[model samples]
Target: MFKDRFEAGERLAERLEKMGPFEKPIVLALPRGGVPVAYRVAKRLHAPLDVIIVRKLGAPFNEEFAIGALVEGEPERIVLNEEAVYRLGVGKEYLDRVVAKEREELHRRQKMYRGEENPIEHLSGRTVILIDDGIATGYTMKAALAAIREQHPAQIVVAVPVAPPDTLSEMERLADEVVVLETPEPFWAVGAHYERFDQTSDEEVIDLLKKGKERTEE
Candidate 1:
């Protein structure tokens, strides 16, 4: 069992080195949770690191229930939570509203974290490694892949500390390569596997980016 996200990242870093040097690949991590893991990955690989913000569309009434996610790309893609939508009787109007709100949040985040920096480079003709702490619904990760795919990357990798067996298997269909460190059976919540699964703050995310950028620049 891993001590926490950092230790898990260290283990993942060692395994990823076998794949060879990153050379020019960019490490884009899903923010809030993925930052710590990606920090370790970027440091180990000597690759530039950045954040890719994604917003999940939760069900109406029970907002915690994820029904879909929104991501930005060359051509934006939306994968519906058809099962949840159907079962919950989530109407089109609610979805549209949620999407609009999320879009605004995404933009706000871009301005806040990124400032005047150039938008993340297109993944086309480049190796793109997508990092996340873990996956539960898989909807968020799926939407991320769809967004990345639109840019036509030469390769896409999904790297995570741990995930369910079925979720890991499903990722293969979306990414060129998947570097999963652990696929524990009878997986409980992602937090269960981590000894210190604190809610990562925005400041922590910023600190990671700074450290990662400096390391990669060198």
Candidate 2:
């Protein structure tokens, strides 16, 4: 188990470095929880670090149960769990409402984390290593992949500290390469694998992004 997000990032970075010589690499993190982890990897790779904001689309009554994921863009991208929506008998109106709410939160995050800077626009031919604290249901990462694909990246590498075996397999199919440090059996929540799994604050994200930009300039 990782002592904290920083330790997890260090271990993950080590494994990725061994894979070696990524071409025109850029690290894009799913922010809030992902920034700290991605910062270490970006520092090690000497790659530009940026956040790709993606939000979970929760079920009508159960917010923790994700029915889909939404990512912002010219025309926002969404990935839904069709089976769940069908089984739950969710209607278009409800879906639209939930998406609107989540979209608001996504914009809030983008503004808080990035301020005046524009979203990174030069991903067309670069290798994108996507990082997060860990994977649970895999929907969020799936949506992230779909959004990144729109940018026509040379490669999308999903690197995380831990994930369920099944989810890891699914990621392998979607990303060009998958780098995971652990796939624990009977997997529990992502925080369960870490000793200090505190919630990452918005201020922390802003500071990390500032540091990342400075490093790139250096």
Top-TM-score structure, candidate number? 2
Q: Where does candidate 2 stray beyond 4 Å?
A: 116-120
For each candidate, give its TM-score against the true structure: 0.92, 0.97
Q: After superposition, how far is residue 87 of candidate 1 from its true place, in Å?
A: 2.1
Q: What is the Cα-based lDDT of residue 206 in candidate 1?
A: 86
Candidate 2 per-residue lDDT over residues 110-206, each given as its tens digit: 8888864545467888899999999999999999898888889989899999999999778988999999898999997999999999999998998
Model 1 vs. true fold: TM: 0.92
Of candidate 1, the 10-residue stretch with the lowest lDDT total is 113-122
Return the clash pairs for model 1, or none. Answer: none
Clashes of 2: 0
Question: Candidate 1 residues 13-61, lDDT tens each?
Answer: 8888889665468888887788898888878888888888788898888
